[model samples]
Target: MTEALLNVVGVSRSFSAGEDELTVLKEINLQINRGEMVAIIGASGSGKSTLMNILGCLDKPNKGHYFINGQDTSAMDENELAALRREYFGFIFQRYHLLGDLTALGNVEVPALYANEGPHERQKKATQLLTRLGLSDRLEHKPNQLSGGQQQRVSVARALINGGDVILADEPTGALDSTSGEEMMKLLRELHRDGHTIILVTHDPHIAEFADRVIEIKDGEIKDGEIIGDTRNDNVNAYQSSDRAATELVDNPPQTHPQTAKQQTTKYRINWSRYLEALKMALIGMSNNRLRTFLTMLGIIIGIASVVSVVALGAGSQQSIMANIASMGTNTIEIKPGTGRGDRRSGRIRTLMAADADALKTLSFVDSVTPTVRANVAIRYASETVTGSVQGVGTDYFRVRGYSLAQGQFFAEGNALGSVIFLGHLPVRVIGVTEPIESVSSNSDELNVWLPYTTVSGRIFRQNYVSDITVRVDENVESEVAEQGIISLLTMRHGTVDFFTINTDTIRKSIEKTSATMTMLISAIAFISLLVGGIGVMNIMLVSVTERTREIGIRIAVGARQTDIMRQFLIEAVLVCFCGGALGIGLAYFVGVIFSYSGSDFQMVYSGTSIIAAFACSTLIGVLFGYLPARNAARLNPIDALSRD
Candidate 1:
């Protein structure tokens, strides 16, 4: 005779119950032939369903050998068993086992997708199956939207999608009414007549009578096995004569030829269609729970915003400071008396003089030169009496200091001050009022006055020596080189190194270094916040896995591989963080806009590199933090997952 399509020899199954092993099936011997309609009937808890699970390769037997078409399945791995289920066996459950998130058409196409079918092919096949199953109008309806009978019909269509060579129905009609039950049994009979091997597990005698052979199972043992019914021939004649609609329902035969084991084991190539389906499912999951998704993304949003904003704020502050420095004179040098600052007895030296300024002005590298002498004096102007510094300066002092006048012009060589101001009981005219210089002093209330050096030395203090000289270096000359030239000339004239020069360029370098350090420090703190956001993503993903346990089981039942399940959850997590990153960038820009409008002295300067880095960081967090949850989902036992609420 033909080799048995399914052969079970001495198969004994057991489950752990507390401290002891509870045996479910004992020495179960069964044989099922291709193209034969058989029923394994028993009462509840009789292990009939367990036997059917073994036959369908959904569960393994503790002891014995189960074979499919003369090939032993004892050495097959989890993935190999999944391939068997995908290519050969199809399951119909009492609860209908339809994915809640998928439409009827989508649910029917699931198995075909896992079988590596293309989108257009699977969609066309799914549409035809649903249309023939009387669900053409309900193709887009979700499981919750369909009635009990309609859902079971969709489940039947799903089972037949990937060539159901052997169909296992575990109480398929238990949840349906009498009329719907009769209709379902009729559909099964039609499939059986179309050369599909039908294995029905039920306690209802009426349902058992529809099959050609009935095996009575009791207490995990086959009690009576015989060909009790001659219903095949009679049903064939009756169906042909009376059930014209049922004949039209299953007019086209299912695809019975499946890929060989070698073909199934071929190295898996990247399937873009499968990945796209996973992406679509991920989007649907996120859309269904908008609040949870947004909350999960909030941490990433805050972290990315902090990092980008801090970088921008640092850059803006640095630019503002550098601009102020530039206004003080690009290449200016200051000459002070004595060896250096805070020197003792420098006032008694009296070596610096106006002749030095006149000599420096003759050099080609010196743009302008000014000699300065200062003394604290009491000044009276309009009813305000204040102590201020009265400075003796050359005609080019304003040009050397890069000062712009707010009102009135600088005094000429012999011109007197325009307005009289008292200096130590001597009255002197004011030449001009300089614009407010931020670099000069922090206190805006400080007072200053300027006069010609000759007037201060001869008329006011009656001293001939000058305190110091200020030099504006030519644009083509380096400040350091010019400083060296002046030191050489002055030390030769004085016969010793009695003065020191301060290069404004050196101060600019120091300030820039300090600003950069501050930016790096703040950015490091922001990176810590990003790390915390990654941890938050991991926690929420763990919760998601627990909530969708049943959904995971459904995919497994439809032949989804471990990697397929993992890809779904991982992609969902990445999408969450990616969207969060985009929102965070937007938030950072919004902060910049508000800061600019607040009338602050400096504006935020956002960097393109920082924004791109933030996006990469968020995507990496999604993968790093999302792995454990995805692995937990993929590693779940199919039976345990299905049984969970």
Candidate 2:
């Protein structure tokens, strides 16, 4: 009278070949309650396997309603069905489905991953399960290293992890020798006695005798299904193979859409339980080419460091430059002439004149415009001729050119022209002036200088035109708007976009933006390296899968579900990328420091964002690129996999 753990009513599944429709299952009905074991017995072509597939929810019947724990399976989507399977069913098969990369304990811990238990709890549970399954000694051993019985035991332990009520076993004893097969049957009997609802599919009549019920499937339908013996609906304690504690081996199956399972994979093993395995694998991988790994990591380090350092140092340099410019005066706009020495009005005209500079002062937004004359003349102090460049400017030039006189005051307006000039440090030092040019000390020939424009207005240095017209706009106006206005005015005045251009505050921002763009480009390049690293991870994992094929086949054969295989490989890949990312982050910071110290204006910058970004990016690359190899490992046929060697 107890509620059936599983109920299949009028279920049918079929396939079409050319014009013929072949029914795999036809109008079948089956019901099983708690604490009972049953077998569907038939020959290879008799559709028992097809029925088993439908029973396991690995495949859907063409027509039928399969209810598990009273939930209508037909009403559920693939995702819901997968979730239900994970939560409510376990599986065992003829070939043990033990994961190759994972030790016995790790294999046992696979199903619990979907439950999201912490690593500590998962490991504890896995350990207990392996011990109860008599795999305690094989806990650290890979499936390849274990005997057939041992591998099956690990699969059994994995299946039992979630304590799922039903065990759907397909050919539970098909791949084993008689002794191993008998042992497996004994284990199944023990599980049945422990209150598990098991549906076993087999062809051997002797195997069917162990079940409380037997369904003889022929063609594509259940020809006869009858309860062969008294079925226990209460606790079947005697059937529980382990006694150390029920926690020894729990039961749970995979949760994944079969179709999507063929496409995307999102599976991972318990990290804490398999941390050592991952670490060991990492060590082995690293040892395989310590120098290559180190060098590859070094490239990432340098790349990250170069990028970070450049950002930091560039930011600092820009900050300093902006400060200097601001200090020089924000209202100022540069009007320096170009290198082309063409006539002021000729084709591709570049040579500027004082007249053009004077005309700019008349603009409505303009406040002050100073015509500036410049020449690298070797002026004599007294037998000492210094070839440093001399700047002959109007009174307003000091405010526009960011000239902070190192010492004495600058030139005055309308003052009488004398042999006076404000020199920069280079000019001051060049003249070998021991003291200030006037009342102040200039220890070296400081070159910074200032002079009235009229002084050089007709001299050999300049006659009519000045090289530049530094414009100081109204302080109240937003400098950017003023600069743009000035650019528009000048571009119109010049009548040619190529005849020198304006690069004011508006354009200055574009430079910083361009720097950011360059950073992105560099980042893209670095990501390529990470991808190469990901490929390394994938390649390594694929190799591992090949080496462990037999082990995988064993787990799948016994009871290790598809998801278990996927988790183990993905975890391995993620581990590799994470380790690489951590190292890369550290390297980037150091490179940033180096860039900061370099003399170049550009410096590297590091951010917590970048560090996390690097890690996340690597993880994504691992999953995106790693999943293919991982899935290939997971999807390998158990029959073909174990038969490899």
Candidate 3:
């Protein structure tokens, strides 16, 4: 009936002056109808580009109430404006605005790539458009390989790939020769003929003539504006039809305009097809700069690898230490007798004696008490004597340690002085065994002799049996409490805080502390790699901004919001690093395999949480380091960008 496509009333724009605000545009009014072409023409500094930017949704006016196809423009923020632009506008720029590294089809595919379209959709659309532009042969040819006219065609094709509602062309041929310029202008006319609504901004009067309507601005004011060749003789008839249809459409609406708040609004929804295209574009970009991408990713990869490797190593070391300590015995308490060195109240005083060991055995919680008298001793087995440390103890040593007899049976009580001795499997392997050794060396070749500790022909091996007492507490008693009770009992003999003591729980705590410190140290070293990678991403993204200056300008001119540009660069950076992180994860897995082969008793658990954390960190680095470069691109003046060589 009387549906409005775009409405702008009394819009004004200005900038700062020394002390007074300088007016750029004053009281500008304009409207654009669906399926129509309008050109805005003016000299430089006449605010024509500024007005075009507002109309293309690139910016908001300093003072204006504007509506586009019935949607209010005043209420949108930068991101919302970007979504609106992506949903509705396609931009073609002067200077061909083609990315130097991309082929013709790639140039056409950039926008859809930003939209993240699928590869199939991007390829089909890009190929179809390039073919239509007579660039089927040049699809694989890069921008430098094509003529200026052909490059502009690629740009035009890019604008058309997304099914956007409007095309915004800013001086579309300003950088082309006359013939090539004419060719590009003809392409625009062709696009218009194909039913696309276009708003071409140009200073050339001939270029403005290509549009169906032209608005001329001078000194920031519209000097002339009008539409031609659409005049109908019967205004009364047209107005009468509009008047009647307005009431009918408004009253008996098929759908309520102001439906309940819960209803879904009618904003255009961008298909997910473009996002896939963006991913493909990113892949191509990385391929074009393979070295840069690899270098960038190397930081993250090395960091993750170092983290995993160091953690594995540290974890293994901790386990080994704990196992060795626990292997000695579980819930075993150590009691050391000290010679009198200082204060008698101190445990260093010689208060513990063999009598103390006898007294400890009487305690209710004590399972078994083994008094160890260790020294290097020689074994005489028919002149093949081997020397090793001796552990002199009663039969109770076997009960507390539960050591397996790989060779011979443990010594029995009555076997004392019967030439009986138990050799550890390690020592047994060192010495050769000739006899069956049914008494001692049944498993190993070691030559050991065990004799009674009570009396061996009246010869004394040990004087005081309390050098160290290994107290095996009952498992029925909790280790910590039992240890405390043992400490209290021994403290009287070896006074308070006199002797160094440890238990199963104490060793376990030490192991945990060691593991924690190791994990943190490894992580710190790994983070250095990530930081280096972040610097790489930042550097590359900055380069990209500089390289794609004109492209960024074109996107902004076409209604791409600031955040859109930010997202493009940030995602590109992140994609590169994240890809590297993924590869690193694979590499770490291989390293884990290698570690397993090396006989390291550690489980290299590269859990999903770790992978996701690495990936997320990579992405975060991209956003953090790529932000400034992206912002630099976004803050660029669209006119200056279009004018860039």
Question: Highest TM-score: which candidate?
Answer: 1
Relative to the true structure, how large is the alpha-carbon lDDT of every model? Answer: 0.83, 0.63, 0.66
- Who is ahead in TM-score, 1 or 3? 1
Q: On a 0 to 1 TM-score scale, where does candidate 3 land against the true structure?
A: 0.64
TM for every model, in the order presented, reads: 0.79, 0.54, 0.64
| 157-219: candidate 2 lDDT, tens digit per residue | 777787746787878778788998899888888777676777888989888777877777665
* Better by lDDT, candidate 2 or 1: 1
Sequence-dependent TM-score of model 2:
0.54
Give me the displacement of residue 516 in model 2, in angstroms.
Answer: 7.8
Lowest-scoring 10 consecutive residues by lDDT in candidate 1?
238-247
lDDT of 1 by residue, 1-645 (tens): 656778899898889999998877778777877777888887787778888888887789999999987777899877777877877878898989888988999999999989988788989999999999999999999999999999999999999898787789999899999999999999999888876789999999889888877787776344322222223424433221233333232233233467787655552433666678888999999999899999899999999999999999999999998777756764678888887878886787788889999988988899999999988889987677889988899999878777788877787734543768678778877767889675432233567788889989998889999988888888678778899999989998889988887777776677889999999999999889988988998999999999889888878877888889999999999999999899999999999999999999999999999999999999999999999999999988777787778
Q: What tens-digit string does per-residue lDDT give for candidate 3 at 422-480?
A: 23321221221123222111233443343223322124353544345667777577677
* Candidate whose lDDT is highest: 1
What number of clashing residue pairs does each candidate have, in the order they appear?
A: 1, 74, 18
> RMSD in angstroms, candidate 1?
6.4
